[model samples]
Target: MSSSALDVQIKSLPNQPGVYQYFDSEEKILYVGKAKNIKKRVSSYFTKQHDYGKTKVLVKKIASIKHIVVNTETDALLLENNLIKKYQPRYNVLLKDDKSYPWICIKKERFPRVFSTRRVFKDGSEYFGPYTSMKTVKTLLELIKGLYQLRTCNYHLSEQKINSRKYKVCLEYHLGNCKGACEGLETEASYHKNIESIRDILKGNFKSSLQQFKTQMKNFAESMQFEDAQRIKEKIEVLENYQAKSTVVNPKISNVDVFSIVSDESYGYINFLQLAYGSIIRSHTLEIKKKLDETEEELLTLGVTEIRQRFNSQSKEVYLPIPLDLGENLKITIPKLGDKKHILDLSKRNAMYYRMDRLKQIKITDPDRHANRIMAQMKADLRLTEEPRHIECFDNSNIQGTNPVAACVVFKNGKPSKRDYRHFNIKTVEGPDDFASMEEVVYRRYKRLLDEEQNLPQLIIIDGGKGQLSSALKSLEVLNLRGKIAIIGIAKRLEELFYPDDPIPLYLDKKSETLKIIQQLRNEAHRFGIEHHRNRRSKGALQTELENIPGIGEQTIVELMKQFKSVKRISKATKTELTEVIGNSRAQKIINYYNKE
Candidate 1:
């Protein structure tokens, strides 16, 4: 919008609490937000410099202002939530769905019927949930039916109708599935009693149901009805088994809503725990894809609204690990001690697990996104000026100060680039002088790269302590390439990372992807270096055995060794086979040397 027109719109906005929406030039909603003063809150977007990149993008997209003034802040919060859920504005948390989860309904009738329904009718029926999944609803309903003989029929078994003999028994009664309240075979009193027990179970209170089952079992035992007693005993066991499965937390933590959130740059995972009479009645983790870099408070606030609305939660008390800005009608407790704290921590763990699973899914389904996130994270964690899209790690290896060698392993986008890996036979470094060996290899690697004008790695890692790093740095300095590329060294013992001038080492989180990638690079370089060293040592051993052969000069030995590959192969070669490569005289002499053994 033009500055004058925007100013006029802002001036007309009320100072009262309300929900404000930002629209783009195409009249598409960009964001939805609640505010005590619509003008001030909406104006802040254009007036202030937003530090978040997403917020800056949102501001640029917003071309018009729209708002609804409400009577109070609570109303504003509700309206903002509704608007976000409806339009799913670009900058708002938008995971909530209008389709409510399946709820197990026990319809209020002369003989109540239990079934799962997505649509709830307010006709005095008792509704158990808005469960997170249909599978949960099915499992719960199956457990309920297994414990109680409630009719699955939809027939309205009014008392007048039952007396009039208008309804007849169906296959359900013959199959022993239902008690047949429709046929008056089941007493209304007994049916109502079972309904009461179901109500207790739905409220997560199992004591009453278990006690009733025990009483029936005891009465049946006394009446010599062993089969009936066994049935009642089984019902007791089923009820207890279901209770044990559903009740994860303390029973005293009742009637509270628990929420926790874990987030990354792209998404937030918010887990909600519903507790009733000390057992967790329902638990769900919602994945919120962030359009902007929204704060945890904003995400949590949005989550609380969406979840409670979706599940029809009337919980007044909530437990959280961090403080939220939700207004005063609801009691939000930031738990710090005791069981509440433990439950809050559990919720946080659930959110973290969900986030982890989400990352895994992204890694499998969209590898490029996974690589990008890893690169960004590594750049931030290692404090590198640029993302290390091309990374190289160097390691030196030797056996008894003989056949010294160094290997450079390259990684592009956090994976090993085997084709780019190069092995260096240590030259100008006598014996096992690791520092000098490191300097020679690094100097040759980059000097050749510069000569060939090949792409250099953004970051270089030395797979040793400060000594190896400093040696590598000397080579960079001689080539006038010091500080041109980021360099660090990893010490094996403590996994300490050393920078050129820094005295203290940097320790990365052990589980971090950055640390894992560095470890992978280090291990690859070591493996490559060791393989080359071992081959060199083996060849040196083979050369020693061949060198002792009389009249076989080094040139003739080289030809035989090159053709045969190993001493055993040369020993296995026939005289004519050797002659074809090294001529008749040397071939006859090689045949004599191996045959003399």
Candidate 2:
């Protein structure tokens, strides 16, 4: 952070606890943090050099500071968390998910049906969870089915319906799968009791279900029903196995929400774990894209709100890796060590895995959005006024001076726009003069766009050093577009960026997205131009071969070429066909010349 900017912000900084945000010159939030003493903590950033490369880059980008004052340190923490969640600054961690997690819902019909779903309806029904994975929901459902004979059918089992005998027992009843509640073979009281037991099991409370199964097994064995006793014992084992997968943390740390964050250069992932009686009832990770520079706290805060909102979280307390303000009523804990810390670490690990998964998903599902992010990063890196959404790059291909040509390759949104690509044959330039050829092609390209009033590119890239860039500038000057469009040149040797009048070149990081896109443009333009140049040279050679013939006039050659496309095709032509194309006088001469050869 610059001292000039800090000097002013620190003077107004409150001695009390609060959240602070850093912003660049464009006023985009870079990072969000909480401090007991806003002045002291923020001052520490400018006073010393940071060891981390990311931190140093962040400090240099900081143009201004903003803070929100609060009463206690806890309040500051809460506010910081809220802000981080809200803005999701680039330096802060971010978690984002557009869809809600799958939940196990017990429909509120007569003889409620249990199933897994991702939607949350307001109709009166019991919803077990917004589980992190559908696999978990499927496993729990299988366990419940094994433990108790629940109806899978969606039939109305009201007393009037059952008495009317309107519904018949399906295959499930005959297969010993259901209790035949539709025929009233099993009473509503018994069905409700089983459902209640399943509810407890979904909440990670397996005690009641286990005890009931054990009692049933003991009674069956005592009554000499060995087969029923064995079946009941199997059900007990299944329920226990399901419970064992969960119940990893200390059970006493009940009803606590744990959140942790992991981030990359362009994105952040935050994982949320909902614990009920020391078992993870629900766990999920959210993916977020960083707009500027966000911190871990900011990302976690945002993830918490999104996860809570999507899954309909009502937990009042949340455990996080760092202290921050989420709200006045919500309790926030930052564990120093022990079980809580272990759980927090586990949350961070989930976030890390989620980040990797999302990166792969993005490359496949939404490549356009990924390209936009890369373009936005380039815009910021280049200090360009606008994103280079539509870029046009020019390369001159005057190889060996045989047939001078140039190519203009267009990129609409960080990908090649082949239809808009153009090749020039250097109409106004002579010899191996690249500067003159560049001036002519650039003028022709834009002059037509001006006459037609067509769209212009946000940026123009010249595929050489300052010499080529300056020559292109002259045409822009003639067209009165010197300042209207942003232009730069890339030197091939060192990949240096050159501005119009600036002597010093800006060297972007070799791994930066901006540099990558520029290299793509340069390579594409060179490729496009070289292809056009080769075609022109081959075509010229074919025409020039006929020019070597004696007494072959220009008009006669034109007539022959119009009839025959290639030299090979013309040589294959009969005397009659040649006479028809160029008439008897030239055709006989041409045939005689070829016959002599």
Candidate 3:
């Protein structure tokens, strides 16, 4: 941490227990630590001997340090936990798990059946695993179903109508594997006994069960029971076939993870894989360049440590992309030939492709090239006196004639400055009048800029024709901002560009790069504006419904609506909970009215 920043911050700190945070220039928290003596513990980082390795790197980037004094060490510890959970600092140990893993579930029914599922919800079923791969889980379920002759039908055994003609035996009965309990062809006791045997097999007693079946087959053959012997022989064959097909790539390399990093000058990607019984159980591609500030080697080291901390380990064999002297039992190699090389090559290719595909999906083009072309063209077309550096766009959205709203989005050097984006909930305009709504939004947005003495944008783009352009210009004039800013309106059809005084809009050639750049900006503004409007309108509609409730007038309704944001949420609140918002008597009345309804 910067000594000056730490010194300035520590001056205000009380000589009490608390948690402190060190932040880098990018506003990212570099480290979070708690101490009994808040000032002394935080100041230790500024001392000369403490500056080395990760700490040295952290200290160099430190722009500011902050401290929060607490009542006691326990309070500091609790606050530290909450901060760690919230910020998830890069240096901290984080647990990791694949969010979309599949599981095998057996429903709680009279004749319980096993099935593969990806989703887990609040249903009374016995669930096993978070299997790494859906295909692997599905294959296992198929093998179990084939061997046990379990019912694959959706109908629960208890829900199935007893003594009904619809309960006919399926194909499994024809193979003599199924005890035909479906049609009352076999006693319930015998069917349940078979199900219990299946449950044992599912619990991974395949070897013991197979041996027992083989022994039974031999005894039947010796007693000249050909039919029974044949049945047992078939069961043994199924088990043997499964064992043969389930080949382990490396028996020694069970339950491990492998990670690799690939990067160019500007960006890097981390490729990770989880293995079980030497098979790739799960794979992940993480885009790490956006979060990293270190070199390739530092990123590799940090990535390995971070991932290891994040995930559980069953084995010591963690494969790496490059060799490091961590003194662990990890096998670090850069394979040049053979199966290991092939797998490594596959991982590298996957990482590269993943990075490329992500970049393409996001339409991440060179900002400098596009920005330069657009700025040049805009100055020439709009007859501006100077090049536009900061551009602001306005757009309005609503449904039919309800909850009209507008959005103001800012772009600094062709990238959105999200922190500066503003939204206006059409207060002055009541209905779906786009021109009037646009005027209100523009007026409110620039009024703040003037009031705050903030820098005005060199260019303003509105998503409409001449009417919208005139409204925007009028708003600027009312605020005495005209001539201080250059403005144009973009229309969707024919890709027309209109000015406030122009009677006819100008259409740029479709092939022009400048036109494409402007179109991208205009579309982005529209998308952002529409999204905010929809959210505000939805919330407003919900709030209006809260106001309609008995004993809930506008003011109480506003507080309740602002507190909970929805009718469904308000419905779940009790009288005491409602009292926390308004008061005891009013809360009771509101609760009673809702209860009665």
Q: Which structure among the candidates has the greatest lDDT?
A: 1
Q: Give the CA lDDT, 0 to 100, for residue 455 in model 2.
A: 95
Give lDDT per model, in order. 0.87, 0.83, 0.69
Off by over 4 Å in 3: 1-5, 8-98, 106-112, 121-133, 151-248, 266-272, 295-317, 321-597
Estimated TM-score for each candidate: 0.89, 0.57, 0.39
Off by over 4 Å in 2: 1-126, 131-143, 151-174, 178-303, 309-324, 327-378, 387-390, 410-422, 425-457, 465-484, 491-520, 550-565, 577-585
Candidate 3 achieves a global lDDT of 0.69
Write the residue-wise lDDT of candidate 1 on 1-597 in tens digits: 786787788889888889998899899888889987888888788789887678999887877898898888767877888888889787886676757678888888888888889898889998889887788777778878888887877787888898899999888788777987876888989988889988888888888889888998999999999999999898888888888887776777778999999876567889999998777888899888777677888888888877887888888898977887676788989988888888889899999888788789989999898888889788878988888999999999987878899999999998898999999998798899999999999999999999999998999999999899999999999988999999999999999999999999999989888999999999999999999989888777866898888888878877877888778898899988998998899888888988888
Off by over 4 Å in 1: 4-16, 36-51, 71-74, 93-100, 121-124, 221-227, 477-484, 547-585, 594-597
List, residue by residue over 152-263, the lDDT tens digit for candidate 2: 9877778999999999999999999898999889998898899899888887788889999999999999999999999999888887777777887887787788888876
Clash count of each predicted structure: 2, 23, 2
Candidate with top TM-score is: 1
Please state the error at residue 260 of candidate 2 in Å: 7.3
